[model samples]
Target: MIPGQGGIVTRFAPSPTGRLHLGHAASAIRAHDFAVTRGGRFLLRIEDIDGTRSRPEHVAAILADLAWLGLRWEGPVFQSQRLDLYAEALAKLDAMGLVYRCYCTRAAIAASLSAPHGPEAVYPGICRNRPRHEDTDAPHCWRLDVAKALARTGPLNWWDETAGTIACEAAAQGDVVLARKDAPSSYHLAVTVDDAAQGVTDVVRGIDLFAATHIHRLLQALLAVPTPRYRHHPLLTGPNGERLAKRHGAPTLAALREAGEDGRALADLLRAGRLPTGFSARNA
Candidate 1:
């Protein structure tokens, strides 16, 4: 399952919650290049399951930015339009008795944990055994019972471009939410299902998501979908060496374009392992 073999398919799935930033450009470039050089397909997926944050304006901006970068893709699939598909996958998990309703709020979960641990606090599984009532309308999310899922799938491993073969540690994150109360699908569920539907053979993105691949692998096993090879590239950072983030005032691709910076040139530089003056790269 390597790129350039068997008609490699890669994607740059970005959430339309904000403008596309330099960090996103690096990822898009890598994924696009991987497909183009290997004579394969590159896809664009809009991960807009969060209705509260995702905006049409932002999506348009993302398209404009990618076009500016001279990157092309096959299908610009929108997750919001594929709610039924995610629902079908979730129903399969539910039918297997691997999905449960969780009523715990984020603040409540944080309070329940004695001490914050790991990159994210492990979900305490407060509602794992709660009986579901058909008529109940309480706001709750659907979560995957990781222990039960792992029991069915046994041990799992996924290949990473840089890290090589990695064992799955889905339990470390506890029972993760698969569907949100506010949205029909969660990031974990939508991404796994969409990747499978799109026939994505490779996943290229920032290393910040390396930990998430574990949960995704488990989902692929549970849903009986194909698992793709992964390549988690280094994240771009500001001149101060801090990771680029919206909170840190990282400049957006739109801003750079408006400032008369050459988008294609920037893409070329990123492809050559060179970065702009105020940006740097670091392995996450």
Candidate 2:
């Protein structure tokens, strides 16, 4: 059985890709406050499943940044160290025949006739029906057969603080990858497993991930794990009304620290639901 934490438990899981920016600060503040205010545990998790791009310096920077923002937690969980756990989860799904080998490459999926439209182009299911013998020497990843998975789990839904009870739209995501050729686990798989393993009771994150919770909810049901309550807070955008991103020159917390900015004061502003100067919050 997954060890239970009686009270609420929240985590601030950030990928070790870049320095923490104002957007990160806002999210961290939300989670940190949510847990502390209710006498719950605030945990930190480093989502470094992508070993190729995850850097040690970035991990260190994120830790330093969170501390600088006055956020404290019990322990920092690293996804890299939990490969065996993810492997077990994948093995369970495989035994259930809910996941299959997918050999399609990025270019191939992009050019497929069934390719999805718009900004979010989901998998076109090229390898979903391909026979085992037809599989080539191409590197393969494991994909969740959403149709089959839904058949087993039937209808599913989860609770969200702002949006209320939302139905799981797992089909809209198509056959999502459970294990990548590079990483042992995909975001959807690892997150679903980790949240339950960590006993996370309340997931506080940016609304940009609101849609992803659909897939996550399905995984929770399929895996028979507890579904945590969710709160997808508004995203912080810059003066141009664009969401804050490193490529968009979003100011980093490190830069602010170097400028002698008060981390605690900044966090206080975030707690009060206020954005500094040019930043604003909006649903994504």
Give the C-alpha miss distance for residue 83 in model 2, angstroms.
0.6
Candidate 2 per-residue C-alpha lDDT over 1-284 given as tens digits, one digit per residue, 9 for 90 to 100: 11333498999999998888999999988888788878788888899989888999998888888888888786788999999999999999989978889988888787884645665788888888877677675789999999999999999989999989998998998998899998899999999999999999999999989989999999999899999999999988888889999999999998998899998999889888787898888877
Per-candidate Cα lDDT values, in order, are 0.90, 0.88
TM-score against native, each model: 0.95, 0.95
Global lDDT of model 1: 0.90
> Which residue segments of model 1 deviate by more than 4 Å?
1-6, 117-119, 133-135
Off by over 4 Å in 2: 1-6, 114-119, 133-137
Q: How far is candidate 2 from the true structure (C-alpha RMSD, Å)?
A: 2.7
Tens-digit per-residue lDDT, 80-184, candidate 1: 899999999999999999999887888888778887565477788888888777425789899999999999999999999989999999998889989999999
